[model samples]
Target: MRSTYILSFLRISVSVLFYILLVFSVLFLVASIASIAGNDKAGDLTKKSYSYRVKAFGLQNTNEPFTYSQDSMVKYQKVADEYSVVLEPSSTIGYYALIMKLVYMALGLVILWNFKKIFKETSFRQPFKNTIIKRLRTLAALFILSDVIKLLDYFLFNSYLHHSIASTKFQLLTDVGNGVITGLVILVIAVIYERGKELEEENALTV
Candidate 1:
């Protein structure tokens, strides 16, 4: 009974987050497209801003004793260990960034939906089902792919910056394989659930 209430709460939470993210994803996609298409305007309301975290130095004034690198494009404040770069939505690098963001958001939405599905189909009494196994496997794949996409996005954005911003050096900093671990754990659970399902069916047949 306690787990039932917990499941009910989680299902409701997932549902609410999913719909809210879904709406924002749609609006962002539309606005990004419009901003990319009409990039000739100097200042536009549709122009969205994206931010990236990187391992880079900050811009500061240099003295006679201590000199630091400065560039016209690199505008950053002194921070510890990392820097946050805010990029405007333009026709070049911004478009690709926006697309990657949308894709990542879509992956998150799918993962949440799969969780919602599993919670809907499962209970404390009977938690192992074929549908649950399939959904778990699906979640596993999505989690793995989400990490891959993040790496790809990082590389692509870094490459674009390397070529475009010649004066500044921006290194790519990322979590290399965090999601892979999570995905592997989920896959193991799915396998265990499959074995449990087989035993459950066997016991039913015997009874």
Candidate 2:
């Protein structure tokens, strides 16, 4: 009963998240089309804001001692260790970045759908099923592909920043290998499930 509740909860949560992402993806798709159709205003309006970790060089500390309250005085510098930049459709690289984002969203949607289907078809009583193994494999592939696309986006962003900015060096600080790791873990679990299903079948035959 508790597991039933948990599974239901998970299904609901994933559904909520999936719909939210789907809405955003649809918006992005429209924006992508607009960008492709020479709609600069629409492109600018729908441009996504991306954050990157920054490494600053030859920067001065502009923090001056100031007393905000008489009880406590504090000084702070107006410098950002990370920055968010919006990519527009002004150049070829920007278009590539946008297309990559669309691909990423598409993969993400498929991944979520797979998860939803798995959770729907799975039960605590029958956890290891053949259908789930296939879905898991599909999800794993999507995860790995999403990770690759992410890295490509990072490279594209890095290249864009390298040519655009001079003072501060921007780096993709987000963990890149998690998707592949997760995909591999799922593959292992699928193998385990396959073995479990075989043993279950063998037990059924012996009885």
Candidate 3:
């Protein structure tokens, strides 16, 4: 009975961890989208800057065959500004980035919900085999799905996108961490579920 209680405690702890990860993953998805959108707005502002009047101390002069002059300086500045603006970071990766993020978020939610269900069953002293197998299967599916989304996110956000090199690396690292922690939580839950099943079987045999 004490051992059973220990297993129950471990299972609940893992479930809590899974929930925490789910919340964090959702927050990250939101942040990523916001960041991409913010970049897009910045790029637009830069493009608009091209039309901005360049104010420099200069006397009115005639154009010298469009060669070196104040007019030329303004033109060159405008060109450079346009190029910089167009190249500025944004979620240019488009729908792909959004899709990947949604996938990951959905999977995380599923995993967390099922974990809560499993924890609730354990709290009610339900038989492990009957209650846990389905939950474990659900968890396994979510875990796999999360991994798939993570891989897609990596490729789309880092490879196809034009984000700053540092930001890309940071996003990849955070995604990897999320995946690893979620996977570990699932693994721990599986082990606890199996142990509960073994306990149930042993009790049956003794009875």
Candidate 4:
């Protein structure tokens, strides 16, 4: 009874969000195309750079303002530990940012698509199947991929940096890292659940 309530709630909530994001995704796609078609004036309204601060310890400032190096610190750690943070400029958005938005919206659609599908399965009171496992795996992988894409997008726009982000005012990357970890945990659970389902099917056949 509780699951029914929860399932109903999730189905309706996610369905609404799904359609809203679907519309946004289509808009982003259209806007991205227009930007590519040289709709520079219109594009300016939709895309802009953002500024953010990241506070990291032991950053060796290059003193030139925009460039900083953590080679020594990374060597000491024996890993590529970066003291870098890049944030979006709240002032203006551009072509590249519009493309990023398109990617983001598309990824969100993928997530919501799977979410709605999962809810449908729950609503039907269906047994777990291989397809469900695949869907769960996809959701987990997408969560991880979303974070990775964000990091990559930041680095790609490095040329846009007027200065480095070196403030410690509540680093947002930590939240992204947490998401990555959560995604991994979910992936593990999906794998385990899938295996259990397979075993149950096997036992049923043997009996």
Candidate 5:
């Protein structure tokens, strides 16, 4: 009874999260389309990156995406004056960046929805089934794919941002930690569980 209630709760919660993510995915898709439509000259821009307008001494992400010249000689009042005097050009790469972010979000939501279905299908009465094992394996592969896609996005962002700034190229030189490992572990578990199920069926038939 407790396990039944637990699974029911999990299914409900996961379904809610899945629906919320779906809404965001649709919004992102619309925003991506609107971006191209709104910016008529968006394709002509050479710099393929969204950048922070260096307002002060620090760098931070902002709604206003552009690159600008900075000066230490100017006063606070003069800063605003200078800002209006110069406007940094927008880039077409910003749209692609938004798409990358949306892809990441969509991937996470899809995995969550799959897990929701797994929980929904699970029953205390039926412990050994190939379907559950298959889902687990599929989820593991998705986990690894997610990490690879993330790495690709990071490389693309860094490359575009560097070109926009005329800065030295930076490479991310490290192994993907959590997602890869977790996926492998889940894969192993699924294999073992499937083998166990096979043995149980074989034993039942032998009698």
Candidate 6:
């Protein structure tokens, strides 16, 4: 039926979105681990140049106003040797990394659970209304689960970075943003599914 086709299309679209989220989550987890490992190092060259100034002038003298040619400042900044910190990984970052890994893993499992129906043969069709409503519910549950895991990660990391509670708070805000967007998408899907079901029932009754 026309309604059945519409439901099928919705199912396919939602499944694609789910897979996209799964891929993104996996990439984020990988990047987080790499960052924690110090694979991507970043430093302020200006800080290093300042250190050289301290060496040239005694620490107290260096604090005094000094002028440098623009060229000199540029050259020094460029020539500053890079140094690596012996960063013992923050328990906070490590905890976050672990949570990200777990979340992605769980998403993968869920995707696998749904893959057969979404990707395989086409004979198994529920009523258009029921099919869409069920899929939307599933998507909502997935996002909610992801959000919960993210909140746990934020809390664990924030607790460790308690000295800068501000930074932790900011991280929580960002996570909330992501969660909100996903939550909204889920909500929209749910509403549409329900409306479609209601319409289908009405149509049936009228017939």
Give all candidates' CA lDDT scores.
0.80, 0.75, 0.56, 0.64, 0.67, 0.52
Q: lDDT tens digits, residues 1-207, model 5?
A: 888888889999999999998898888677656655555664454332233332222334234334444864543323321111111234434655666767878788878977987887787766667888988998899899988986887667556655654543333333566788888998998898798899889989999
After TM-score superposition, the amount by which residue 55's alpha carbon in candidate 4 deviates from its true location, in angstroms, is 8.3
Off by over 4 Å in 6: 1-96, 108-127, 160-174
True-vs-predicted CA distance for residue 151, candidate 1, Å:
1.4
Query: Candidate 4: lDDT of 64?
Result: 31
Clashes of each: 0, 0, 0, 13, 0, 0
Name the regions of candidate 2 deviating beyond 4 angstroms.
32-83, 163-170
Candidate 2 lDDT over residue span 134-197, tens digit each: 9989878887887887787777767777776755666655568899999999998888989999
TM-score between model 4 and native: 0.63
Which is the winner by lDDT between candidate 1 and candidate 2?
Answer: 1
* lDDT (Cα, 0-100) at 105 in candidate 1: 91
**Number of residue pairs clashing in candidate 4, backbone atoms closer than 3 angstroms, sequence gap of 3 or more or interchain:** 13
Q: Is candidate 1 or candidate 6 better by lDDT?
A: 1
TM-score of each: 0.81, 0.73, 0.46, 0.63, 0.69, 0.43
Candidate 4 local lDDT, 1-207, one digit each (tens): 887888789999999999998887787566556545653443243342333433333545333323335764332222222334333323233445566767888888888899899777753444667777888898899989988987886565543432333342222232357558867987997989788788888988999
Which of 1 and 6 is ahead in TM-score?
Answer: 1
Measured by TM-score, the strongest candidate is 1
> Considering summed lDDT, which 10 consecutive residues are worst modelled in model 1?
59-68
State residue 18's C-alpha deviation in candidate 4, in Å.
Answer: 0.8
Instruction: Write down the worst ten-residue block by lDDT for model 6.
Output: 48-57
After superposing candidate 3, which stretches have Cα over 4 Å from the reference?
1-92, 162-174, 181-185
